[model samples]
Target: MSLHGIGLVFLAVLTGTASVLLAVALLRWWDRGPGRRGARLPQGLDGSLKPMVLLFRGQRLVDATPPARALLDRISAPESEWTRLLQWIGPRFPDAIDGLSRIGRAGRFECLGQSGTGSATLRLLVEQIDSDLLRITITDPQAEYAGIVVDSMSQQAMEEELDLLRRSLDQTPMLVWRQDAEERVTWANAAYLRKAEAQADEPIGWPLPRLLDSPRPVPGAGTRTRRASLTQNGAVFWYDCHSHPTGDQTMMFALPADAAVRAERSLREFVQTLTKTFADLPIGLAIFDRQRHLQLFNPALIDLTSLPTGFLTARPTLFDLLDKLRELRMVPEPKDFRSWRQQMSDLESAAATGHHVEEWSLPGGQTYRVTGRPHPDGAVAFLFEDITSEMSLTRRFRAEMTLGHSILDGLGDAVAVFGQDGQVIMSNRPYRELWPGAESLAEALACWQAGAEAGSGVAALGARLTQAETGLRDTGLMAGPQGQLLGWAVTKLGAGRQMVRFRLPDPAAAALADDKAMLASAG
Candidate 1:
């Protein structure tokens, strides 16, 4: 009876084992679907690929492969939670999280290893495995395997990077500051503190305008650069400010530019002064720089040169200006066109040393006194003055003198002009014949005195002339050439001058007059 009972228990155990084997075979056949027939699945039954296969349900990590667990441990993540995994690798997989929430539900991302380690990049693929499940597969597309280990020095490296950025901000010459979304300053560099002259009591919460009068608008969501000014220590200062926006904050940098601003202002003032001085000048003035380009010209220069204001404003070169002047016939005419340019070149060379000066007679019957003088800093200046009226007057005076000489020479009487110093200044042809060897009025008088019988010659006449008053006239006889007696008369002229005239004797008339006088006396 005991054996039969044991046989029945063994038979029952054998039937249960056959039913379990048949159920296992059916489940295996169902798991091998047609979609997974050609898909390359990872080999190795020891769960080596398990860490790389993550299963998610309702955005939660329900299960993970062995590779994924190894990766999370290498990244030094806190727990096996989905949030912790995303946080661990979010910096490297920025686009993956966004794509996971979208329809179609397929995304790719790059997974980087920890800092300070040589680790190969992992290509991560996420796709919907079912309606309520997602599968994440990590693979090395380049087939280069590397250990995904987190370096122990990652925290130290991050701290060092932050310290380096802070030192850079402090050493930079530009003033740098950080502001929060509420427009409240949160951080400022050493340069900012120095430029603002901030006291120890001042904190980051201080108003921006109080440190330096900032007039620019607050930066929005982009980058911008602008110029601004402030008054410090009773002096105006300039700066070039730039801004960059972060997620919820903005960074600003202000560089000093006061020197450039002041220099530009001084140049403008100097140009204004020069313009005023040139405005009042009567003579034509033109100035050229070292490059031979015209830099300045006065109004007189435009009028005298007859060049258009637009042409001058275009800043023509010196050669171009002269060429235009020549075309207008405003300058002196040259013998040859080619030679004229060469002459201009020579003039420029000579003017460099301030040794060029000339008179230009234009075709318009105008005369100009042109002078070229060297100016400071390798510059040149040209001056033009109209002298036409003065030259015309001189010509007219010479012509008058010639006509007066011709009238005096045609007279029958001998005439001589004397100055206040008793020097013979002018004489006609007749006077020259009478006193051929006399060099001066004093010499001629000396000859007459030598030829005189007593005091009746030029000596007596000279004495009488000296005693005569202004506007007085006197007549006398003087020994002429060939021992002939000539009637001489003296008349005082204005401006300390005297005129002397000599006349020939009428012998026949005098003798007739004498005979008549004798007959009258006898009767």
Candidate 2:
């Protein structure tokens, strides 16, 4: 009973083992079979297996293998997948697209990739799959057969980085290009191509056209910049071209400089206008920089200071200019040399913070009004104005006024003059003595009315003095404050001025003066 039961268990175990072995063999075969998904590889140019394969139906992508899909994914273009693939291979195999159209009749075609595209070892095969379908197979014999393995993630990152770099270079606003040692343009970005097209009024092609002219004294080892201009449609555009040497080739970049150039031109024109204005000014103008060195001077400065034009043009310091003036006897003589230096220092300090004015009486009997003003950026401007004629006229007018006042004082009668506004403008010493504290015309009128006897015409006299009309006169007798007889007269002067005079009226004195004249005649 034990042998039979053990035999049955052993047979059951053996059947189970054979079934498991058969299942394992079938699974292995299925996994390694040609019918497995993505296991079929397209034939290469030499009839070897290639991993990269793509099928197209009249410009439409129908199917692609894993490596081909990865390559298409790596390429970035704003075009259909079939067009993108063509673009990716166009540089490597320029005739690949043309060969595909003829593949229907030829059945197959092969092309070797071109150099400079990093695909020289690549081989492309185009074959007719059906009446409307075409197949393309790209193979790199070295990479496919040489056991070269690449991490997919790393390759994807590298492709993205390359795409970003290409986008940045193409979209930048600045024009960029590369030239060989012979100054032949080798490469250019999209911006460069656009500018070249606009300038030429046509499309741009390979071996880019040169935009900026070659600078005088060719660029050397380091970066060099030159200003270049481009005229388009009757307008000039400016650019600052920067060139950098890279090995035997040179890299160039052009930045727009139109705004900067316009600003500089405006500044130059303004300076020229200012120079012309300064040249014609009568007052001597001297402008000093922050360092106190003379930066600008007008012709009047030379004429006024008697300074040599050569010396002023040499840009002398403030102190040096003062020293020259002192030597030429143009400046007022100082008490001592040390005091003069101190005075000069004080002048500079005052002029820097605020305005300073001084009067100089030269030895040649001429007077000058010198004004110093602070300017922006710690600069200073000095103006020298000749005021000799003005001073002389002022002195002459003052002397005439003094002489007139003396003549008025010498009069025996008390005299006071009133303006049209009824304000006392002039008064002699006698008038002041007669009417003490009577300064204005109203006060004088009040004093005369107080002293005058009743019905003495003082009110009438005041009305006459206040009238607007000129060339009128009035005379009368009034009693003084002491009861003494006084004679008064008011005569209108020109420009609405009135002159009033008062005198002591003595008939006895008049008779005495007549008898004395008779006695002297008898003697």
Best by lDDT: 2
List the lowest-lDDT window of 10 residues for candidate 1: 144-153
Which regions of candidate 2 fall more than 4 Å away from where they truly are? 1-173, 214-221, 467-473, 479-486, 491-496, 503-523
lDDT of 2 by residue, 392-505 (tens): 999999999999999988888889988877788899987888888787878877887888776446766766777645554488777776677777888768887878888865
TM-scores for every candidate against the unseen true structure: 0.47, 0.63
Cα RMSD (Å) per model?
A: 20.6, 16.7
Cα lDDT tens digits for candidate 1, 1-523: 6999999999999999999999998766666768555553343333333225678887677888655665555555565467766765565556666766672544343343333222334455777767877777655444422222112223333554577888898999878887776666678888877765543345444655335433344445366777887666677778888777776777777888888888999999999998999888878999899998899999999888899999999999989998999999997889998999998998888887875898899999999988898999989988988889988998899999999999999887888888777778888998888777665657877766766655555765776555554443388787775778888887778777878888866667789999999999999
Compute the lDDT of residue 7 as modeled in candidate 2. 100
**lDDT of residue 52 for candidate 2:** 69
* Clashing residue pairs in candidate 2 (N, C-alpha, C atoms within 3 angstroms): none
Candidates' lDDT values, in order? 0.73, 0.81
